[model samples]
Target: MAYTLGIDIGTYETKGVLVDTAGTVHAQASRGHQMLVPQPGWAEHRPEEDWWGDFVFVCRALLQDSGVDPAEIKAVACSAIGPCMLPVNASGAPLMNGVLYGVDGRAEAEVQELTNRIGEDTIISRCGNALTSQSVGPKILWLKRNCPELYAETSHILTSTSFLVQRLTGEVVIDHYTAANFSPLYDVKTQSWVDDLADDILPLDKLPRLLWSDEIAGHVTPTAAKAAGLAPGTPVTAGTIDAAAEALSVGVDQPGDMMMMYGSTIFIILRAQSQVSDPRIWYAPWLFEGEHASMAGLATSGTLTHWFRDHIARDLDPAQAFPTLANEAAASPPGANGLLMLPYFSGERTPIHDIHAKGMLFGLNLTHTRGDMYRALIEGIAHGTRHVTDTFAELGQSPKRLLAVGGGTKNALWLQATSDITGIDQIVCEKTVGASYGDAFLAALAIGAVRRQDISMWNPTDRTITANPTADYDTAHALFLRLYEQTKDIARDIG
Candidate 1:
């Protein structure tokens, strides 16, 4: 039986799985890594150590653990935390640590500079996005301004996934879903790189060739095959970013179908039948060429929860702290005992698009306990989700089905709070192994072993998290918006 290998390089860890045509995971492996915060508002991952190293390790381990013939695996696919900015030389050597997604606020000034130089309307019309912390073009400019020597020496600009694919097949390519974040540099209408707009950001030649997500990038070369303990010429799909893969994993393919990915950050991707020209949210062509994707994300979600555990619940074992905290949070009342949190630890993204936004713990009092604070954090991220869903409603793009995926799906409090606050029932699939599972599915699709529509059968919905009426959540959501509005200027001043 033909099997497929899927690996994902995430912010805090890398995970991979081997799956057969029946969607049964034959083997799985994981490796944990740290996200470097060199300074405030900066997040970095070494591509060599974290991205490629994890891939080789996971691939070899999966083959060893499964004891399956390497020749039986038909294809390989991968996803990663993106739209990262990794400048590389002609030899594909990384110039510096990869700059992370919206969380890394190093390019805030560059985002503004681009908007001023090229009109915002021009960018939105041509690129389907405005200059924000998430845009890769601005990050390239950041490198040019801050590290000119390195920038001048740079021969190519690639994301984490692009770097990995190059390592595997010795081919440089990026998917449209991921390339969309390279706003102003990527032409959405033409679905290709436009050197005219990109010239000021970086040399036109620095960008990778574009392809749809499921298209075969290239076969793994002999060198990569030996490195990864696989056969030469194994087919590999043009993988996407983690959120897109998670959406695909759960069968989010139709119009109005959405996936609320609760990973290190809270990401939402809504499949739109037509183009959504919204500056408040991002717009990208779907993984498939003909479809469209309307997306939004928070700067921090699970990351904030981790911060709370590390600082507030530091006494507990790191392995067990999350479960313990979840238990404590469950014991607390729904409104988090009058505590409200703004989950902008890194900075806010989506609707507000405020790069200077700071996290706040409001309504904290002598009566509050650590459990209450923990509950507050979960609710805070939920409130943030509500904000994005609200945008969809306001824009007449409300999701027909909301599929919840990623680690946060296991946290009942977080899932329930999100549903209760958003009033949208969420569908949880049987397999929440997340992006790696989607990668396997994409690999299967690439090889014609499975069709795109087969995801519903491959990973069926397990259960639905129905929205429960919550009086406090409604009030808390109002205050959540008010708090951000009131603190807008203050956050900018302090930041």
Candidate 2:
């Protein structure tokens, strides 16, 4: 049977899947890696070790476990945590570690400088996005200004998926969906790169060639094939950011469909009928031509839970900690026993875009327990999700259907709380394999083996979490907003 290969590099782990065109998973594999924080406000990943190394390891494992011949794999596709900033030399070797997404706030100064110089109105009009930490343009400017020597050696500025595709096919290319994040560098109207907004950032020649997400970038090279254990001539598609693939995997096809990704961060992607020009959210050309998507994300979500488990719940076994904490949180009353948390451990994104925001645990008293704090943390994340949804509603683009996916969906309390707080029902698919599973589907689509609507057959709805509003949560959400506003000045001072 003809099969396809899909791999995804995430913040904490990499996952891969081997699947037939019929959507049967033959084999799956995963590997873990770290997000290095060399200093405050910076996040980096060793491209060779974390990105390409994980790809090679996962590919070999999938092949061995499935016993599938390399030549039988018709197409290969990949997705990664993106809108990342990485500088590579002419040979496609990474000049330095890959700078991560919105979580890394090192380019705050550059974002402001460019926004001021280019004018926010002009930026929003031309780019369809505001200069934030998530934008690759400011990050590139940061490299040029802060690391002049290294920037001088840079030949191409690529995102995580672009870097991976280049390594596989020896063709430096980026998808329009991911390239949209390079505000002031990417023109949304033309759907191409331009240097008119900020010529000082980098020459357009240094950027990768842009293509649609499903377009064939190139064939795998013999060298890459040997290392990745794939056929040398297998076709590779122009991959996109992980979240986009995840949305497709869960059948987010129509304009009103939104995918709520509960991964390292709470990333949301809404399929839009037209371009959304809100500074609060983000706009990108969809995977296909003439389509659009609006995105919003929290700075931290699942990562905050990990932090609490490691630091506060040390008494519990590492594997059992999350479950135990969940049980305890369930025992606590709604509103988390009057506790409220600000999930700005890294910083805030989307609506606020406050880099100096700080994580706060308010209403803490001696009466509080670890369970209450954990519950509060989850509720805080829910409040953030509600904030994003409200913004979409204000823009008259609220999601008609919310599809939830990722590791956090398994957490009953987290899932239920998000639904309750957001007042929106969430649908979970049968295959929550996330971006990698989406990658497999994209691979099939690229080779004309499957259609976009075929995703429903591949992974149907498992269940839905219906919204259940509560007075306690309603009051808490109000305080959640007020707490941030009242204390933001102090948070900035402390930061």
Candidate 3:
């Protein structure tokens, strides 16, 4: 049987999966990488050493583990942590480390300069996004102004996924979803490069061709094929960002369907009939034709849990410790005895769009214990998810169903709390291999092994968690709403 390979380059790790057309994940491999922090709020990844190195490593490992001849693999797809910035020369060598998504804040001055030059209205209208650290246009300009020598040699800009595609296929192509984040530089209406904006910085010709996520970008090159143990000339599709692929893995294909990704960051993908713009939410064209998606992003999620465990609860082992913590949290009643936390460790992204906001824990007193603090942290993330859900309602686009994916869905406590906090029933899919698995599915669809709508046939059993907001939660939620309102200004000011 013909097989497909899917690879995902995440912030902390690169993973690959080999699968048959039937959605069975035959083999999988992953390798961890570092997140460079040169200064406060700056995140970078050396493309060659970090991104591509790990990608090639995982590809070889996955192909070996599958025990299937690489020649039998019909196609390949890639999903990456992006809306990232990677400036490359003509031969596709990284000029410097790629600026990471939202976590990186080195482009602060660029954001301000773009907002001043283009005005906020024009940015929103053209890009369907705002001048936040997430946009790549300002970051490109930042390189030109801040590092002239490196910027001078830059020929083309590539997102993380596009970078991998270029190496594999010898063709530079970017998907609309990832390209849309280059606000004021990517014209959303035309769905093409905005040559007129960057007159002197970079040429329009350097930009990669744009394609939908599932469309064929190119075939695997002979060199890449030999290294990856794949058949030469196997078709490679224009893949998408990790979040978009995660959403697809959960069957988010139509309006009112939403996928909530619980990972290093919290990302929501809500399917829409047409393009909708909200300053609070980043918007992108859907992977397929005839659909749009609105993104609700929080800069931190599992990252917060990692911080607490690694730094605060250093003595405990996470495998054994998290369950103990969960039990302790369960012992405590809801609301964590009035302790609340605003999970803005990496700055708030969705709803508020405030990059200056800092993390806050409120209502703590002598009565609170370590368990109370732990419980409050989980509740804080639940409250953040509530904010995202509320924004959807506010925008007149209420999702009828919420599907949870990634490691976060594995935690029953979190899933229940999130459901209760948002007053939405959460559906947990059993086969959640996440972005790589989804990318494999997209490849299957591209090669005509499966029909697009027939994805439901492979759906995992739904373990539903319904969070019914109680009168007690009503009081707590009212306070939760006001907590951010009263503290947002202070968080920004202090930062």
Q: Which candidate's TM-score is highest? A: 2
Off by over 4 Å in 3: 197-201, 469-472
TM-score of 3: 0.97
Model 1, position 23: C-alpha lDDT score: 92
lDDT (Cα atoms) of all candidates against the true structure: 0.92, 0.94, 0.85
lDDT (10s digit) by residue, model 1, range 19-70 = 9988999999999999999999899999999999999999999999999998
Where does candidate 1 clash, by residue pair? Answer: none
For residues 184-295, write the lDDT of model 3, one tens digit per residue.
7788788888856546556677777899988999999998887767789999999999999888887898798999998888899999877888788888888986678998
lDDT, candidate 3, equals: 0.85
What is the full ranking by TM-score, best candidate first?
Answer: 2, 1, 3
Ranking by lDDT: 2, 1, 3
lDDT of 1 at 242: 90
- Model 2: CA > 4 A from native: 469-472
* Candidate 3 minimal-lDDT segment of 10 residues: 195-204
TM-score for all models, in order of appearance: 0.98, 0.99, 0.97
